[model samples]
Target: MAAKKASGSGSKAAKTTRAIAIDAPPLDAWSDLIGHDRLIAGLSAAIQQGRLGGSLLFVGPSGVGKTSAAVLLTQTLLCERSSPEQMAPCNTCPACVQVRAGTHPDFIQVSKPDDKTLIPLELLIGPVDARLQEGFCHDVHLRPMQAKRKVAILHDADFLNEEGANCLLKTLEEPPANALIILIGSSEQRQLPTIRSRCQVLRFQAPTGEHGRQLLRKQLQWSATEDDELQVDSVSDEALDAAIELSAGDMHVAIRLVRGGGDKIREALWNQLDAPVPDPVAIARLINGHLDSISKDVPKRRAALRDVFSIAVQHYRRQLRNDAKSGEYDPATHRRLDRTLRTFREIDRSANLGTLVDCYAADLTLATTGDRGAIG
Candidate 1:
């Protein structure tokens, strides 16, 4: 197969350097993949028995191994040396190397661009003028050049809008005999019914218990050897435990807490909430300050604000549990928890960040102080 050309105007060496800089670390071997043992076992068995389906929908929380799993499956299918029954890729082979480098002739991947909220229609089908001359739908139909089959993994499947989904329906319904299509999204509920119905759904849960601890350590670069005790120097054992407890089994959340100084933010939030009379202005300022420190990008700040809300939710829940254990029902605590959850949901829909934060803080304060007037 010929080497893939880099897009845009540049010398070959410059384009190659740009591509290498942006590429994520490749999952070269199954050992490089962490967590989801049971899912891997089932998928491996299906591949070995030749029972794997043509289309698959992977639904899970963000930062889980769905994309990595897709890449691994592609390697297993397109490996030059591994037999179908073996289901193992020789990572050094040309086919495996190309796949890892994301330059494989038979492999295709697409996602919603960072600047755009939805997967554009043109990405699924060609632009109006060219029709099916380009894009994922067009490319997936081509004959495989290297491997016996072609594989296309579409990331951010949650962002596929109605028009884009419709463009993909015919392909999903009558997929090419030699092609595999995989869609990765956060949850099945986020996907449209029509799209979900046409593919095999695989639900992935966040790692928990020992699995969560191990994966957290691995991501943090804190894990030493399999037999050695977990090293703790920069991050204390208590901080690690707190991060694990608050992360809700998501590795990304855990890392953010330990590395991003999210723990400090969490503490500040708790301090504000636990005050005798919580100050809405102070609370809003605290949260906004934390958001600003984390990112200058609006979308990223919005996402981090959601995480802050999640932390508040946990705090109220913990208080409610404490009240329950003490044989005292605090209606105010219950209302605050419910309102915090509602505010959390609203973050995605609301555009005015300043207004949203101020209203949420004011509403939480009112709930705490037994005031009847709470903003929706």
Candidate 2:
């Protein structure tokens, strides 16, 4: 492995601000990795067997506890005290407290800067303009300050540009002793082949069925075992179920959906779905207005729009699936629906939300009636 400089240099001031000295929260417990019992067991067994390696890659959807796993694994590795067999951290220890408070000297976490599109190389290897500064690459090579092991969680591995990835290759390939490097991303394919080959990859899947519902209940803090006890005038078990279905197994998304007027949003979506031709612009404007009324942040509004599109996609998919089951599926209509779904999936934050919504509605209208203008 060779050392190289990552591309797209940042200004000295930018570099200083780009790297956030985060004091990440310590894992509540390894049990918090809900819906992943088998993976947890395997990892615990690996710790017991002393087979844990330096470089581990966790790949999964956005909200599936990949980072949480990284934090827990760090605790297991660096805990001042733990069980002889299972390697569970003793939460009462100073090491555990520091790790929990994100103030651990040996534990470092880095992520893509929210203001930038890509993780700058300067952030990984230190600023290009500086000669004697510690970035992730240089810092990881140093001995631990407080613990026997040093753990670094690279949160936005996918955002690492070619240069940044190359710069970190040597460190990743030949990590320093008593150091653990964890790379997290949405999928294995998003990572460079070089990065993927060097690390032990752990794939995480979405919790579904009973696992999903249980997690939702836990997250929502609903303790009612009986259905009647769970029901409130505004939010109920049915609403929770609807959020779970809409979220498509993504718990973060489900939580967001539930918090952001789950029942009302679902009702509005279904109403639009039943229309002869759903008016996407009107729906988009309505959603935008609602989100703006609550908060002025554009990202918040964009997320709301994405949720709306996701619901639309779910509705069309159900229609297509039902048609197929009944032997009434039309190939042309099916193709159209598939295209509409693709359009929704592809809508990004870069696109104008209102226009994107209009385009989606038009596409659906065209798919159903061959008249794109019908929805407008």
The 10-residue segment with the lowest total lDDT in model 1: 6-15
Q: Estimate, for each residue in 1-376, the C-alpha lDDT of model 1 and write its tens digit.
A: 1224212111222222113211223466666666787787788788878878888999986655677778778888999998756757888889888777777778888877766768877777666775655677877776777799989888879888788988888888778999999999888987889999898888888876666666666666632336644343466656766776666555566666776667788888999999856899999999999988888888878778777877887898899889889999978788888877676446544447888888788888788432324334
Alpha carbon lDDT of residue 99, candidate 2? 66
In model 2, where is the ten-residue run with the lowest total lDDT? 1-10
Q: What local distance difference test score does each model get?
A: 0.73, 0.68
Q: What would the TM-scores of all predictions be?
A: 0.80, 0.78
C-alpha positional error of residue 326 in candidate 1 after TM-score superposition, expressed in Å: 7.1
- Candidate 2 local lDDT, 190-297, one digit each (tens): 799999998989888877766766667665553233543333335666767778777666666676677677567667776766666656676656566656655667
